[model samples]
Target: MNPHTLHAPRAPGDIRQHPTGAARLGPELLLAVAAERLRAARPELAARADLTTPQGLLDARAALTADEEGDPAGSPLVVAVIGRFDLPRWVAETCRFALALPREPAATWRRAFTRTVFLAGRPDNLTERFTFDHMAEDGSTAWAGPAPQETTTALRRLLKTLDASRELSAWSPVTVEVPGAPPEGAARPPVHRDLCIATARVTVSQLLVQVNHLLVEAVLDQLIAPGDRLTLRAVPRLTGPAVPFAALRVDADPRRAHQLRAYAGLTEEI
Candidate 1:
């Protein structure tokens, strides 16, 4: 993971010089420049008449764009652009917000819940880029991720072991056999945990791909829970009105079951 320090410019069009002598553009201009570069690099896609611009990207640009009365420091988009948004804090907040909402049917809730979480930072695709780890107030880690795929693999292995154990009587002297256990002469499973944490400096784009492997441990312990609902909203500027981006309800029980099936499918090859 490449770590980057974001320095917000004081005004529109102002260029900030990093310690390494690299110039940093203001968020709005930076995005605009990126958009132009993409358009240039993918001319055919940009020219496609049937393709419409993404609303989230447009909204992000609008939010980041500076106006005479607007202050860049006051916008959450700016914070995200600078890679300063506290993701874990926002994830907790989103969870709390969802739980407080009126419940709905499982299907209805999952659609909404997943949509809200997925769209939180659509322009930057935060969910795919960033993994959230929930550390409980009791000093317990509830979630960690090396990435979603690896986490799913770990959870599936744990679940399979659990299923095997259930098939045997508690008083049985014989050990419950795991399907993929090492051969009798092979080395035993390692007792020490192999923790993989991303500690390298990262740019905003690179940081999104960095995964914390501890999330796999959380999944193995069944510590993760689905929230009932989430509504993703944003204030373009400090004085601007709050724009409702996405909202959805999720039934916890159904969502949990759905997640199990999804993860099982993801790791079927393992």
Candidate 2:
């Protein structure tokens, strides 16, 4: 299926009105504001030549206006700066909570955990529509069957893992109980559940990040014109003041994709 077909249509007058009037700044000034915000967010990183100094600003302006791709100047891109959330941390915490349960086998618990993370609060039919991977001892992998049960039970269990009443906006820290090491000279070794959980955490985190990147790419390539607007809202559960993560005026430059990939903190070549 064409991925573009999945995006919801943007409503009329959907553009966000910034109280500071920053949104109305010319592209050059807006990019400067965005760079300043990035610098403030990540003070330790070495400053980028395209973002930090006066000469850098001038160079960026020159590059933007060069119109190397021969596309006409269109509507100005309006990006909404949303504060960052620690999604990987949350995923790890949730996985720890699920893995600690003694009632189910690790595989069953993981299946339930995956469904709760990705499919909870959605249609039940979606569970059967999506397939997950199952690895074999011989290093082969095959498509796994749908989750054995509905996510309702798992969702309830996972929700209890965090206390939402104390502070609704922040992620509540979970206390994971680490299994003790096996006694010395034991005949059997300890179950490798910790390693399995660690692997699951990494897999889930990468998938979530890639899903986010795909959404951004779709918006850049298909949903909006060069001068149109895009706003990323903050994750509601993250505790912090909203801030611009990164901002760039969409243009015909081939490097635009790389800028976004960098903003996403993705290391792989796009």
Candidate 3:
């Protein structure tokens, strides 16, 4: 299994996320915690791993880990960086090919279906190019396909009802509409092109910070419900507004589906 994928398991309801606002934990601690994960995987063998063979991967992981020991999950002096798993292809490519954009540079990641309007000076857009030394976790470039669900109507309703006037709101239309245009055909989507705009972008930095902050809530979900599970019934498809993403439609009852022992085993019960 991919070591990166061996993240802290999600607990139902007691979601544990990276804290936020004044509560945000230092990235050093996160690295320490991640390093702890490595320790768990190898026990006393962490120091013995072939750190030299893989070279940068081990170095990168170490740089992000508990370098000084003690409370790996909580510490002073952390390396805090912005970005997440769900990013524009351009951004991902920059990181994958360019060593995670060490110094900022300008770039744009467009959606296959619609125009992508990246606020001109975002960090992901402008960053130091790294040698494409890293491989995507799955060794694939294709974004994961949409989850199965009935989302179109609910999404339209949610969009129509969200109060965009508030400082913090959902379904906010970042773009304004233009004059008449022909309908464009839908095609396979890249990541940012097709996920719910669930994040709050107070700033590009804030966007990364808050999303990672949710890691605390994700952790809590697990702590609150030791064995129960949760599948984020996320809105699928394009990341921006004025763009429609797709979902799987099925007529199964959620509760009844849970009655099956398969409930524990099936993430698709929804």
Number of the top-ranking candidate, with lDDT as the measure = 2
**Poorly placed runs, candidate 1 (over 4 Å):** 1-52, 55-134, 139-141, 156-270
lDDT of 1 by residue, 1-270 (tens): 110111122223222323433333224433333333224323443344221233333432333233211632221110111112343443333233323333332223222111111111222223354444432232211222212233333232322211111111111112111112233553334121111112222222222221111121122222212321212122111111122101011011122321100000000000
TM-score of 3: 0.20
Better of 1 and 2 by lDDT: 2
lDDT of 3 at 172: 31
Query: Each candidate: what lDDT?
Result: 0.23, 0.27, 0.25
Residue-level lDDT tens digits of model 3 in 11-115: 221113323211111232223333443454444445655332234235534543443243322222111222233333323332232222222111110001011
Query: What local lDDT does model 1 show for residue 214?
Result: 15
TM-score, candidate 1, is 0.18
Off by over 4 Å in 2: 1-22, 46-270
lDDT of 2 by residue, 58-142 (tens): 4444443343224322211111111222443332222223323334343332212122223222222223543333212222211
Query: All candidates' TM-scores?
Result: 0.18, 0.19, 0.20
Can you give the lDDT of residue 124 in candidate 2? 28
Lowest lDDT sum, 10 consecutive residues, model 2, at 192-201
Cand. 2 Cα-lDDT: 0.27
Query: For residue 188, what is the lDDT in candidate 3?
Result: 21
Order of the predicted models by lDDT, top scorer first: 2, 3, 1
Flag the better candidate by lDDT, 2 or 3.
Answer: 2
